[model samples]
Target chain A: MHRQFSLQPFSRHYSHSTHPFLDFLDFDGSEPTSAGEPSAAAHIVVRPAERAQLLDVLAAYKDAQNAGTLLTLTFVTVNDYLWLLRAVSQELSQLGRSCLYYLAAAVSDFFLPRQRMSEHKIQSGKGSLHIEMDQVPKILKPLVAEWTREGYIVSFKLETDEALLVPKARQALARYGHQVVIGNDLHRRKFEVVFVSPKASAPRADQGESVPGEHYEESWLRIDLEQHPQKEIEEDIVSELVKRHQAWIAAASAASA
Target chain B: MHRQFSLQPFSRHYSHSTHPFLDFLDFDGSEPTSAGEPSAAAHIVVRPAERAQLLDVLAAYKDAQNAGTLLTLTFVTVNDYLWLLRAVSQELSQLGRSCLYYLAAAVSDFFLPRQRMSEHKIQSGKGSLHIEMDQVPKILKPLVAEWTREGYIVSFKLETDEALLVPKARQALARYGHQVVIGNDLHRRKFEVVFVSPKASAPRADQGESVPGEHYEESWLRIDLEQHPQKEIEEDIVSELVKRHQAWIAAASAASA
Candidate 1:
């Protein structure tokens, strides 16, 4: 079975598991059966703080599913999103090369830790306010190296400057040694995107090889909004990733054999 | 004719006017008709930044009104809210003692001014991010003394510490020389609120008199959720405020005569 995990702060919620293979497979107490076509199942887990709201969301998801449309909703803080990402990646590692991860959420780069946050609202009696926030740990590094070694992980790089898109995407891929980095400019994101990944012969950092700028490949994807106003760029993006993921799975299987 | 102006940073779109008495009354190109019962008209003006979305909201508001419900939506920055408040208050001042300003929105105390804001997104390469924000100007002072001299203004003070409610509310009244300050604790806001105002026969600071701690009166309003789960505390708050506003109007008329 194909498992998907999606996490977003203050909006979407999906589960991250720390269980073994059997426990993961038996999430809904159903045995896996081989079928001609691949089927996907998504699980959503919410924090204990919002348990009451979680129940309401669960009921709503159930109603939507009954009507043939799958839907889930929950809210999370930045800390919760990080925790869930780590936990979910470790659990999905059990699937080995069969997994494909698409990370599209706009996660905040900096956040005030719980200990440093003010208990009461900051009084305006002070003339000015100064705040210091720590950078959120880059979780993709551990996700690629330790959490899910064989999985096809895709991360996004969003930039306001158009010139920085390709370079930033390459930097992310080099830093984290991930499968793909999709770069999009803030204003032009709707119609265009660039996918940056390593060339076939390029060595991965995790494999003890230093990857350079020449070893990376960039592919641009564009859709004409005037030609097809109803079309979404996500369709092209998903199709491209699916093809790459299948090749990855085949390469992993062949190496194992 | 009664005119109401509401301003919120985001989610609520409202208009603030800088027009004269005649221009304010002729907002919709309609002449004012003398009606026995007080009729209220609300105008929503959006900033030029969201002019496109404003049209959509206006259309939505029209649809909702046609269906027997009034609804409006728009988003604004802290700066927009302050500007709208000042402009709207100036226009409403033409109504003299008939105007009542209810300031319930939870405006941020600090904000990064546009001139100091970064042109691009702050990079995470820096270990920690330090941001300094200027204190948002306290607009209530101008709204009371300069914008609307005879208007009955009610401001809100929300505090985490319950003990600070009455004291802070009184301080707001003494500082701004406004008619009322509604104090509510952050946690118990839904069920309880305290109205702090100058007691009858107590001198107001705007009247060249030194108002002391004992001069302010605090009236608490509470609704038990167990007794009436469906009831909202706002209902009681509005009723009390309406009574006080009528008395204020009468007092202003007597002084003018």
Candidate 2:
């Protein structure tokens, strides 16, 4: 069944406090000297007021540039993000089975349709403001079936309620026919995540023999903060995904042979 | 008549692209070497992923720290900004006529009340989402009457429609009994601003003799970008406000004597 969806574009004034990527970097409050100095080398401090400058700095960083480790692009609205994602995915699809799509960013679930939006600022004289937004269309279906069918797709499901994680992840996999869904509870996300995927022996949904809960498998990955105070949970998650992708590639090659 | 107001707190993920402050800074696409090097000294570059680090860098900047020019604070929600504004104004009130409040930030007009918020993410299974928000309270009333009665208060009115600028600004001054309301159209904000204030010889609103259009005056400030490309409109705005503030302080001193 085809579904009609709506999305509202939300924008905010830039303030450094809400930056998402910088949240991962650890910094000491001490001052650093010149760029080549030992103190400066130990800590990298940047104060980009907007995204363009931030991307520019990241693109120019000596370590990242030498390693060819970072590539950056920015989008303003929901539609901008969607278009960029589709274009990038299509380009990556050229790699076929080697490409692994790691979908992480939390795209807004709802948006205000352009037709309903006011041209001027909504004035406060109206006592109260009522806004009816439409649901942002689910794009995972197209990403899996059309954009990159041979690529291994791993999507993320973050939930405030812990109980919803596994079920939501499973539902996403079934609905989109994606390879895996990494489910994480909001509070416990830093320390734990569960990977939900179709079980190796289970019948595929396309075969019309698949059962709901019985056809899926859940593998939990966790880290001990006490033992490894400095370790990131992403390290473990990425390592596991790398192994899975390798196996998938090997199986595809063997089946073709 | 007592008016009810509603405010919604809107938040966004940090993407350098939407930063408001950085929009003012000029950057050429060039790399910098060491801090003491002439090339590095010529241009300042910062890549702050979030607000905290950005503030930290600003606080630590040598020029600002030595000049005692910059003080920064960040607020996450509308309520937080309101509370902070109130507390700061109350403290500044002690300065009496010497204090000047330059109210600029484009505060959100509508906000969802805590009681109406959903605990979990709004599922997209529902076809559309409907939200009714309350108009944010007009804090200027209390700010002028109570927070700092003797202080010079300058509020701002920004409108997409040019015709509404003067009327809206005049209405604000009459309603709040403040000293000035700087009105500017969104498109021409950077190039021009209209300072709307009560006429010097007009009867005060407190005297109950004030008329709407007759009692008020407007002084337009404009900067020709082609003639003076390097000049900022704020330079003129501040210089004018400083002169007026000196006159206000002198008048109060003479009256008290």
Candidate 3:
């Protein structure tokens, strides 16, 4: 039996002696090792050594199988990969079951990098790993497109290329078939943006074209999926996908019907 | 040519773009029905479709060859899978290069029930996939251990049996020889924890006692990395690992000396 838990700030967590989380990042590299391998990098570090210790801790916890004792900490890069005109999509994306990839955490397309990691240390004799950098791709693009391709019916993010914002976003859906292309302004924040379905259209609401057009704007809003943990965002996304998929299904069905 | 775009929501992402990510999670079922094919589970549905797209985008961006545009996004997760962890260590195991695997993004340890996928609409009238999740070895443990096993120092994470208040945070260094441990409380809205290192018995900075002592009462103060991203909480995390690594190097140098 395996249990999952995360340590939150202002929180108290426990580990068993026989649990699975048997290791911590060791700042000290005193552990034994074979020759020819390189030394660990300085940027990413964990502490402690005996992974088996943590593993034993987790193993025991799993045996006990207590959900209350099970907690988790997930991370996300905020605003650094803002390639959109709004932020709502990000809120939604962040709301679902998420994990973060730190190594790939992209710097914002037009943002600043203060070298915060080594700002002070750079001047010290300790040495530094500084280098000039350039803007990387908006991180959301890969996630959005990949999720869509997996038939997860997740959302694709679009930071409107000011020159080709709508066109590019719309094409993403057209090309990737993203369930909803969340288009946001590069400058806007706090979840303001248009949620676009892949067909270059918006989800139809019987409210009779609230704006005389199918695409209705839902201003920046936060999606609290975790607050209502019992509620399934996965299904919500799936239901939405199925609804949108019906059109494709219908067109496909009709063509053969 | 290899662009690391976000995986679009499952269904919509695939609606239009044939060029879009197909199945970030497709790594599964399709792994191999081939004769003697290795096994796979198509669950981690993040960027399956964009795997190739990522290559394309990366190629374009790396060479500055793309005339149209380039998009990038990054996601990270931690696991103890030996092979995967080893791969991570292999990928970013550079000298003075710290590999930070931010624990963000969602890739569950489950796959949807195939019946749910096949008879989804017919059985429920609403097509839905029931994901059966199980625990897999973490993605980070293996790498850190491998780094150590390979003679390279590496850091790791410990999602404790308890996340909030960890008594083990302090002793982590001495027990495991960790340079530092970034204690994270999962419940905290943002990452909140202490960068714990083995303070020397004499209370030397970064090399003091392994377990968090009374001095840490003041250590739990509110400090934001953004405001001051410099003061490496895990400041010695890298250094500690490096020291051991350097020691080995020094040992080698002495032999050469």
Candidate 4:
């Protein structure tokens, strides 16, 4: 997301008050000073324990870079996002690799036509502003069916009210015929999410019977971090996804064999 | 505005990778440290020049606190805001103090009826979700006329399109019968604004003439930040506002005299 949306690197504007830590780590990206000294590095003070932890992080970052593990791609506008999907579709076809589409962008539901948009800034002389916008095309259906049919798709449904959360998520899952719909409330999105799957409610899954449904059985990967305040929900979500992907790969290999 | 509407302070969630600053600042609002150290002093570090600048800030902060020059009332919800305005109204009547209302909050245009809102979190089981919201009452109109009457009201007009900016600002100014309407486009809000006043276009104040009709007496407050890349636009904006406020105060005094 930073690759496409942000003008400056996220780290650059992390915080004015917090730059001392970055400077202490020798990762401050500020330009060279007139004195030719590392920008305020001599002034950075930290405890031995803190220094050691930062060093560990720097080492891990360098290791990841050396291992060619990072992919840098950014899209700034809606058009850029559309173009990125097309590019990814072509690349995935060439590589013959199944992908996981984790959709988490805050997409606008409606938009004004680009051509009709004023070239210059809008003047405030008009009495009350009334905008006419057309609903944006729901692209997830085409993406699921045409672009990445073999891939697993996890879509997020974030609603302001708790009442809308589950229903909208189920609707998304049913509409797109996707693998998972993670429902989250806008107020508590960071800590709680309900993973909805179509096959989870099937009675025979508990009996270890093959359910007559989609190739992959539906299930909800429910993780609540409310009790464990220190734990990150993403850690559990990522681990569960990795396991699911491995299982899918192993099952496909067994079927072919 | 987080003091009014946000669940958490913005700085708390600022860094995705580093929570060290929050830890150091003890702004994580977690348990007290064993050492009982003052978080601000210990965590702060700066270069020689920056240290001098910080000293100046500290001096000013101390002066303000010593002089009892700060009002630290905090509101955390919509109801809180409403109550605060009511309290202020009563206080203003007793004190008979004029005000400069600078409204900068991102207020929601619509809200679900409180009585109809779901008591529990919305469940994801329902197929599709539909939401019906009602327009929020236009509180600013009453605020301008009844609550903060005899005060100079400066309202902000933010628009996405550049072309609609000036027109919308003028419209707001005319509709509200306010002193100043500061117009900004979302795309370039940080650096530029068009300050629209009904008096600006009025036949030259220098000429001591009165002009009829309001076409547009707009003044653009543009900070060409290219030269001084590190300069904040707020610094310029605040300085300009100070002059305008001084002028307003002087005019009020002279008119009474």
Instruction: Please name the candidate that would achieve the greatest lDDT relative to the true structure.
Output: 2
Q: Highest DockQ: give the candidate number.
A: 2
List, residue by residue over A62-83, the lDDT tens digit for candidate 1: 3454476532323267777777
> lDDT: which is higher, 1 or 2?
2
- Superposed model 4: Cα runs more than 4 Å off: A2-80, A93-98, A106-141, A156-227, B2-99, B105-140, B157-178, B183-233, B254-257
Task: Report the C-alpha lDDT of model 3 over B122-184, residue by residue, as the tens digit.
Answer: 111122223333344344344444463333333323443343234545554434453445555
Fraction of true interface contacts that also occur in model 1? 0.54
- Candidate 3 local lDDT, A65-144, one digit each (tens): 43455333233333322433123234445534222121212223332245533422121112222333334334444554
Candidate 3 vs candidate 4, TM-score winner? 4
Best by TM-score: 2
Weakest ten-residue segment in model 3 chain A by summed lDDT: A11-20
Better of 1 and 2 by DockQ: 2
What shift in Å separates residue A139 of candidate 3 from its native position after superposition? 34
Q: Candidate 2 chain B, which ten residues in sequence have the lowest lDDT sum?
A: B1-10
| lDDT accuracy of residue A121 in candidate 4 | 47
Q: What RMSD, rounded to one decimal, does every model reach?
A: 17.8, 9.4, 24.2, 9.8
Give candidate 2 regions above 4 Å deviation: A1-60, A67-69, A207-210, B1-60, B66-69, B206-210
Clashing pairs in 1: B14-B45, B15-B45
